[model samples]
Target: MQTSSTLTPPAIRHDEWALSDVHGQYSDANSHADLYRFLMRWIDVSTHLNIGYSRFGQRHLTNANFTRLIDRIARPMLELYDDSVHRHDRRLLDIGSGRGGAAIHAHQSYGLEVLGIDITPYNVERANANARRRGVWPAVSFAEGDAQDLPIPEESRALVWSIESPAHFPDKKKFLHEVYRVLKPGGVFAFSDLLAVPTRVRQWPEFYKEFLRVWDVPYLETMETYSEALWELGFDLRKTEIVTKNNIDIYTGYARRYLTYFRIPGFYKWYTGRVRRRWGANLDNVREHLRHSYNALSRGTIDYGLFWAIKR
Candidate 1:
């Protein structure tokens, strides 16, 4: 993957929380509770995929499927460190650890003591439940906490990880600061997420508006701004990989999969029930926006980024 020097455009922000609507409309009908559950499930799959877990399954990583992802993420970083000099009883922290798959995988497979945290109670609870269900309880625990003010002590964590969650944070700088604070001296942090770029330089405002309506998340920062913020917060750059070209293919494949998965007799009815009830008036526009995302991705106008850094 190639890293680009050109700065991406600033993320779009909306006064209204459009993401809540997207969650409400897309999940099953008549229940905001159900919407919450659906969001957690989606995050689990997305985070795993974002971090290189290719297989899609709800069950815990039982077969070789789970360990492959565990090794993929940790083995490279571990190799980069001095084996004889590094801490053996290293403490790892995972921010926004959806479903605890990554944490449990790390603990059981790599023998790393881990703590997974998420703001969503549903995710936290489900993750903890899954940990126990997999018999990795106590070793891998989930905590309810905000990423902005991490509960971990300063200079305590050997490694920190976040996948696809920071984009939702309203303040990226503060969130970066928290990650920096919790990481031990010389600790490594790995992060990956979608990058926002202006549709056209002069049409930023219009593109920003389109951005929120499409992703339902606010305040996604660009790769340039993100790197600058990390440096400002005292992190030494390790490696930056631009996954945009590949992510375009990945997301395009996802959209196709979504279409096939949701088009099933019972599944389509399950998905569009609330969408029709709540946004019946704007259904066409919503469909149009979804099409634009798929088309834009296929054309490579948008992309995802992955990077690693060390606390300086």
Candidate 2:
């Protein structure tokens, strides 16, 4: 169902959590620390998992799955305009950069200056540690800050990137505006995230609610809606596309892993009853609702979107 109108309740006290904690919970389904290590190294999902691979109906994503996803999603943008050519001597900021993986990749591979920002202290600490270990400490650093009000100088960044992070912002518009304000002219702001589906499925409200619960996200947006905001914010609409389930291999692979590795009879139950219980209220309704959500995706009712944009 479409995320734009879902309108989940705003996050409140105790709803706040560290990024590491969120990672730790999700990490339970897949025991892949190397995946985390890999993601931090590349700063992109593609560095962690191969999206081309799949098992069952779900995209089986190892840490490597993230890498592959990023690789595929970013191909169009990079093809249109390889900002790195001009950014070798410039600075890049990765908003909500989890564990600084892509930041590390940019610094080590392309030798571009990079800065990562996130609200989670654990992510900031871990990212810094990883950068130091990679010998990019001086060139790549992670900072603690809010996404909506980044502590960066105006017109200082040549490239801004986010991987599956903008949806976490309470006000996506504010998040975009902030990034726009900081970007220099002709700079690029590229990202890949779980966008809202185009239509709302009233029957799947529970599934929708659980989606919000699992991620603590107040809202999600369709790529179309986000594109409109980007346009209004002065971002030149370069290329926007949906990473259609044409490649379900990635998801199926993840499904197989869950069933084979974790022996989880049902991934939804394990996630909601086990992972979400820590938050409170073992809502059976939510659990069942999420099960349906899984079914919907498994049956091709929902889709993921990948978007790319640039500032004029």
Candidate 3:
């Protein structure tokens, strides 16, 4: 990744809130509730908490179908198994499950029992409500828990799924170990996340550092690092692929939506006011971080990856 020194850095208004503080805020129920409410109102109607993937390439996607694209990203994980067996016996664990979208989809589409866990209690409650609304309440349940320290029992889940969520984890290694611990032997752990290209990170240190602060992640590991970690943790690294184009498409779609939303009368004012009130001085930092992320994605300083591994 080429570093552009010509780009002007945004002013940092909030010096008190460090990366650790931001991470804590995410786990704070009240804080995350406010954030989720804002996102639901402004981002997408379908309650997707992550970037949606686009298949027809970046040129053809619109905000209207962006939510559907999110579901599409999860389809491959669901299709990994044969659903011919008894549905009640098949358990799928969704780590960092947001609003139960993927959980409900798995239950309704594949007849699998889904257990969705999130760090925020409010998100867990919202997920349960969404599950009830989707009529998959009993089959799909949500709990408040951390991905790094899962509440699940050993050999409890047949499949552990995470969608664009591990990037938020402060410790990816511990989370991967937890996933391996909870999954049954021969079970699969599948996920998608933003990754830093090792070569690019070395070249663009400033951009990479800003990305960590903005993204609320401690560090972004390359695909090679992930494979090595998984292999060392007794996982059979089945698949790992770079999907940077899809990530670019998703960010582009979101940018379009943000612009459209800004055009709405008083929408930006109201949204910004709410965020500032809730987050205080950190608001400007948040905005700057997002700007940095968009630019980084466009420049290919970062990449999106999809990975699947079976517990050995």
Candidate 4:
């Protein structure tokens, strides 16, 4: 394990005016609003921003168990660089880090010094506050930055990771290059995200296209395409695993929970009315898209992919 003394303090950029602008934009975007965060926390009060992992053979898991599984998936990336020679250099850069859960988990579990960055300043603020409340403060820090243009210096990180965030990147290739630039030689880059099976994408129903549009994801790269891009950027591919089954199970569980939660008298009316008023027709579109996304997973039109590679 790496001791804190060997780790350099994370450089956090502060642009107060820009942060205020981002906060206003983020609040206006319903998907990124505090209510959404509240709903997510309602689903799982634990430290996580991902859909629950279902590898335990249960369609649904307790919040704690689900968060534990999320951490379990990240453990292998840490283990890959655990040799004695590299043990003292465990610095991590988490791109698109939401609420700092994954960063905090990595710090607590592996003693990795983590710096998390997200485009949303509100998320960064909340994540930093979470780190302080959890007593991890300086060991795990959060900042606001775009993934495509990482704020860190070149070759500064021993590991770069993201969770379920690549699909949201408008220019994934640019982000890949940035990841390569920031990682030390032999450093690992690990991530998990939604992928499109090219063959199935062309065959997708109209509803699926609507789902993609509503979700703000123009397109997704297949696992093969993603790996090829990594290779082109000079990363040595180490592992790629399809975890679509777990994603499907997770969505199914969420749908079930949504229905059950809605059954509570005034809650459904209040929530739905609020969404309808705020987002208008987009509310129905978003809900329909969620359903379609789950179906797309079951039909193999979309997949969840976990990948790991080394900067070589």
Candidate 5:
């Protein structure tokens, strides 16, 4: 806990307390885990947590319709799967799998038996409940576990993937090393991550700061950094791609919608009461947060990277 002496003013400062929660979002002491427990408690993971995939000219998809986009994150990576080698069985592991949507999708689509692990306990419970509701409970299981110190045994998983979740890991190198540790020989490892360009980030620090503050990211590593780490760990890199435009702009339109919503008189007061009851913090500043992140992505300060590699 921070001493009161180091605290920011509790006034109606969006970037401080009232509207913007620029404090305790992420740091050496405060992690993304704390941010989820404190600030993002009210968020509905099914709809809000996953980034929308609009690459195929689709937009505004909801409910079951959104599953296609969700599968996009897993499909490209799982395409490496070979039925010839494992004709009767295919098992996979998902790191930081949120709410079990993609895990269930993997099972339904590719006949993969998936084990998803998440750092958040509530997310694990919700993911298990979702698996039961989807009738995939035993086939698609979720457990509470940290990424940097995965609970799974070494040389156990034939395939593993994570989707858009590693940005929040305080120790990116440690997380990647752990990923290497868990894979079986010839196992394929795939993941998509939000990345940073160090030079661009250093050019405009505040935009990056706001992006981290809103999203609860401790720090970021570059595309090159991750690729080099994978090579150093003896993984043969199969593919690495970055499409920042597709990853980020999906939310800019929503940010504009919420910006208008936030501008409405009395909306702040109404939201304040709702958040107090709902364990929420920072919806009022969601627009600013998204806007800054989009700006970073759009301006080349950050990147969205998809990687596929195999252990030899």
Candidate 6:
């Protein structure tokens, strides 16, 4: 995960998001397609992008039940999906679907048709190839689109889920409105994202600010903001789960291990050499990003939240 944050450091208020602030190596390089590919090239799965979940007594980075544990993280969201009710149009819309890991998993595990929309065209192409490789091409497909303004039609989808992608979204409230606009009357919507603990975040810039800068995250919306928006947008919030205990420390530990390993000059060269020269992301930036992600998460400045609701 050689992620380079484009956000300027010394962030006075990382949570205060603005449209103009999306610059530099953030989405600019991603507009060229190669940035996303280059940044996440080392990840094991071509279709995987999200930092997966880990449970109690389970080592997240080296868990014997890694796949099952990841699936368990999504179980809360999946519970809101009524397979019977979604029979009319069974396509599960995955917004901000990076490389289609969650999308393919949905089709493979639940036998449902899935449509994944991502902002990066390269990822869309790569995700499609991955689906074909898994023999789920037609059943699971990827397209390039924005979450704030979906290309999908209004009131057409029965189920929508986003996994750990909304943190990068500049306008989470607008994204939620778009979700509400697209789903059927009783459509189920679910997502997992980094949520802010306002006071904690304000108190820990040393750990959290670097995380915002390295990850190129605009800002995180709080549980209050999102839950209130859900009701105001006409959705009945079925559940809100804070799973920091199971996830943050695990991912943080993974980064700590990588940071340690990267300290070895031989290993650093090996990893850097692997990156394409044209789209080379600063390895230092990636390390800083990864380090702070875990640090901030483990310290409680930020949290991982899963929210699922039904359209009223």
Q: Which of the two candidates, 2 or 3, achieves a greater lDDT against the reference? A: 3
> How are the candidates ranked when ordered by lDDT, highest leading?
6, 4, 5, 3, 1, 2
Give the alpha carbon lDDT tens digit for every residue of 89-111 in model 1.
Answer: 46678897876778887887777
> How displaced is residue 175 in candidate 2, in Å?
0.4
> Which candidate leads the pack in TM-score?
6
Kindly report which residue stretches of model 2 are placed more than 4 angstroms away from their true locations once superposed.
Answer: 1-61, 73-88, 244-249, 256-296, 299-302
* Deviation (Å) of 82 in candidate 3: 2.3
Global lDDT scores for all candidate models = 0.63, 0.60, 0.66, 0.68, 0.67, 0.72
Rank ordering of all candidates by TM-score, starting from the highest = 6, 4, 5, 3, 1, 2
Off by over 4 Å in 1: 1-11, 18-72, 81-85, 199-211, 254-292, 299-301
Model 5 lDDT-worst window of ten:
5-14
CA shift at 139, candidate 4, in angstroms? 1.2
What value does the lDDT take at residue 235 in candidate 4?
94
- Cα error, residue 4 of model 4, in Å, equals 47
Task: Give the distance in Å from residue 111's predicted Cα in candidate 6 to where it truly belongs.
Answer: 0.6
Query: Which of candidates 4 and 5 is the stronger one according to lDDT?
Result: 4
Q: After superposition, how far is residue 298 of candidate 1 from its true place, in Å?
A: 3.3
Candidate 4, residue 289: Cα displacement in angstroms equals: 4.7
Superposed Cα RMSD, model 1? 6.2
**Candidate 2 per-residue lDDT over residues 16-96, each given as its tens digit:** 434454455334222223333322333343222223322245433345444455565546655544653444435768788
TM-score of each: 0.72, 0.69, 0.75, 0.78, 0.77, 0.79
* Residue-by-residue lDDT tens digits, candidate 6, 122-233: 6788789898999999899999889999998899898888888898887788999999999998888888888777667767876877677556677777777777789999
- Give the range where candidate 2 is weakest over 10 consecutive residues by summed lDDT: 46-55
248 in model 6: Cα distance from truth in Å? 1.5
- Please state the error at residue 67 of candidate 4 in Å: 2.9
In TM-score terms, candidate 2 sits at 0.69
- Which parts of model 4 have CA positions greater than 4 angstroms off? 1-28, 31-38, 45-47, 59-61, 256-286
